[model samples]
Target: MAKIYLDPGHGGTDPGAVANGLQEKVLTLKIALKTRDILNRDYEGHSIRMSRTSDTTRSLSQRTNDANSWGADYFVSIHINAGGGTGYEDYIYNGSVSNNTITYRDKLHAEVMKQVDFRNRGKKRANFHVLRQSSMPAVLTENGFIDTTADANKLKSDAYLDRIALGHANGIAQALGLKRKSGSGGSGKQGYVEVITPSLWTYNTANWDDKAVIVNEGEVFTVARDKFKVGNGHMYQLKSGLYITASTQYVRYYTK
Candidate 1:
């Protein structure tokens, strides 16, 4: 079994980044918890652990020590960015690491970019403590800029956070070759939708006016089928039972 260790950066008094009325600690924990839940519910043969599940203080060394003691196979540190920039970027240690670590990083970056509505800041390298000190392959992802209004708004959405979690979980499962629980139905080969507009409204029913949620641009979701008529054009039904416009102007459907 692969032992995965998740570290939610900054907690308690040390909120990593605070902007747009949001705390980095809270968002990181939310993503980590959701990621763990998704992995446990849909995948098998992997054991997951977190540095801090609640709002508690933890030093960088302490967190790494815990994972090292536990003999974690992989380490993923989740954090938010500040300093007036937007988009997603992840870091591996600048120093030499195993080829497995680089491969894992590539898979993670691709999966997260596929699922989240964020600009690609490119896969990067850094001398971050989490990466340098961890005994196993480690990746630290800065999801989005908390100081930027556009990115912060997405961070505030539970559904958006879930997408982030899904992306992270997807990467881990792929890197470890974790098997899908029988009938988990997340096997990407199914039809899916990728938002192309600034925002696409989903409806609980086929009616265009029956709005349910807003899926931001670049976000991807699995669809029930190819497409079906809704009004003047076509709509794609999400596996979540929500309907979205299948117009090429708003979304592009694909099967992986």
Candidate 2:
């Protein structure tokens, strides 16, 4: 099992960078949380831990020390840039690292860039504490410049943030070769669902509230649990731990 350690940059009084009414701490935490959520819900054979889950104070040393002590397999520090630049970039330790470190960074940077429509700021090497002190392969991502209006506008959107999180989650899973959890029912019967409508909204829960993400028509998702009662209707539990309506009006189910 891969042990993934996530650090949400700054927290508490040390807000890191702030601009365009966006705090680096807040955005980092948001992305990190979503990334963890996706990993836990959609993937298997991996364990995840975060440096900070809420608005609280944590020192840089404390963050690295925990990962080192735990012998984490990979460390990812999520942050927002504040410099006069824009777009996305990532960094690995400037010092010598295993070949796997560079490979992981390359895969991660590419995946993140593919998901977000931000400028490709290129991959770099830095002596960042989180990268240098971690015992395993580590990457620090500067998502976008918080001070840059164009980047800030994208950062402010919930859908955009979800994209950012999805990028990180996808990269991590790919780099580590993590296996996706089977959405098949308890009977081990595999099934799939396709969106028949022009668009469909998925929820984190079986209820109507807490919409997780939107999927376009023809998009397919694995059904973890075929169908279960939700109110007077029914919902399909996806492998990602998300729920979507089982109504034939929006989706069609297929046994695979």
Every model's TM-score: 0.78, 0.73
Residue 153 of model 2: what lDDT?
87
Point out where model 2 deviates above 4 Å.
183-256
Q: What digit string (tens of lDDT, one per residue) describes model 2 on residues 187-239? A: 22477889989988999988887798899999999988856666656688999
Compared with the true structure, model 2 gives a TM-score of: 0.73
- Per-candidate Cα lDDT values, in order, are 0.88, 0.87
lDDT of 1 at 53: 95
**Tens-place lDDT digits, model 1, residues 1-256:** 9999999999988998999999999999999999998899789999998999999999999999999999999999999999999999999999999999999999998888766657789999999999999999999999999999989988987767877888899999999999998867653347778998898789999997889988899999888854555555567778888888865557766555
lDDT of 1: 0.88
